[model samples]
Target: MDDDIRRGDLVAEGEPEQEFNPGIAARLPRKTVAGGALVRDEAGRILFLEPTYKPTLDIPGGIAEYDESPYEACVREVQEEIGLALPIGPLLVVDWVPALGVWSDALAFVFDGGILDQPTIDRLVLDPSEARAHYFLTLEEAAPRLRPSMARRLARALQALTTSRPTYTDFGR
Candidate 1:
């Protein structure tokens, strides 16, 4: 087999090595993406979902599927997990979660879900299989229920709401 002979495969034998190799794509940074809704009730309490699959409490959201935008994923997850077709609002927080044990680094987004009325909260239809329960709590009250980074993210999201700007953070810190 000559080096110049064409053997069509993953890499062609006849092709000279180029500066930009196909392997560059694999070496490029690949980060996970997720979206969450910073839903709030009229009492200024944040809506936090107790996802059955998650060890700790999380907002109504999940990882973005292939071909789906983070906003779309957030909207879909909210409806699927909480049975609410609420119009998602502006992006509040874009948190860059650091890679943890057995977990890849991720870019997590938080969108404003605006304040829901009492009746709307009452009408929330949570699927027992997806979430065992839900809670509406102040940041102080909710911090204990979430992982430290998430608690920070939530706090930053709330701050973004007040400031009318989105925040970027390193693992929500």
Candidate 2:
């Protein structure tokens, strides 16, 4: 992984240049693991959440606490974020986002989850600081709505589910 790190720019004679690189500092291992379900409703729409600060939509999951397991974190996050009770099962994807400088390594475990029969749309609650709104979309509709990285990740996950193939991972795990 250290090989992935590289120098940013060159310094002129007798001049010191400020270094700017994605991997300049030692990358810390992720302490907080998270998971989310790429759920499709009966109407064939995928569930998504619009974050309060971020312009793009995302799956419902966040950082896991030190004592919490990934599955527990998933269940808790879904309930806290959308007021839904879901049973999480199986691991889907474990991704790393090196560009997020602060929390550089994020282990995202996507799962096949159980959905509630009744919709909790009206009763949905949002953490004012975390989310703004929520919506559902079909693959055809969502492709254009997501940011480039999100779109690619979703596409890859969906393709893996469709083809029963394993996904590529940057981390050794």
Candidate 3:
């Protein structure tokens, strides 16, 4: 191999060298991305979903698919999980959840789902394949039933709602 021929560089034997930016292929921090919603009821209670596969309750959202944005994923997940097509609002919380050795670290975005009326809530059809049921509970009542990280994210997202600004947290702290 010629000294001019570096690894990852493409060239024909008699053709001029072609340049490629190595940085373009630089590795980025490995983190899974997820999106969630902070839906509320008319009486100021948060809505939670009980997934069939998880012990703890969860918000209505899921892992973003390839080429999907967090907001888009949030909307899709809400419809898929709860049959709600309500427009998702601005971001409320951007949380970085640390890995628990069982999975990769994740960056989660929780968007404001606005408020739902009793009729709308009653109309919700929970997708049994993904979730068993849904409940509207005050944060205090929800803490024990939710993942600790999720409880923290809820607190942060509520604060964001009150302040009308986005909040950031690490490991849901």
Model 1 per-residue lDDT tens digits across residues 6-53: 245327545666757668876888789998999999889989888888
Tell me, what's the RMSD of every candidate?
A: 9.6, 12.4, 9.7
TM-score top scorer: 1
Q: Which candidate, 2 or 3, would have the higher lDDT against the true structure?
A: 3
> What's the TM-score of each model vs. the native?
0.85, 0.67, 0.84
Off by over 4 Å in 3: 1-29
TM-score of candidate 2 versus the correct structure, residues matched by position: 0.67
- The lDDT of model 3 is 0.89
lDDT (CA) for every model shown? 0.88, 0.65, 0.89
**Between candidates 1 and 2, which one is better according to lDDT?**
1
Name model 1 segments beyond 4 Å from true: 1-19
Worst 10 residues of 1 by lDDT: 1-10
For every model shown, the clashing-pair count is 0, 0, 0
Count residue pairs with overlapping backbones in model 2.
Answer: 0
Model 2, range 25-132, lDDT digits (tens) per residue?
Answer: 546444446777776566656778888867778877766787666667787788788776766655666665443566555666666554434355555677767788
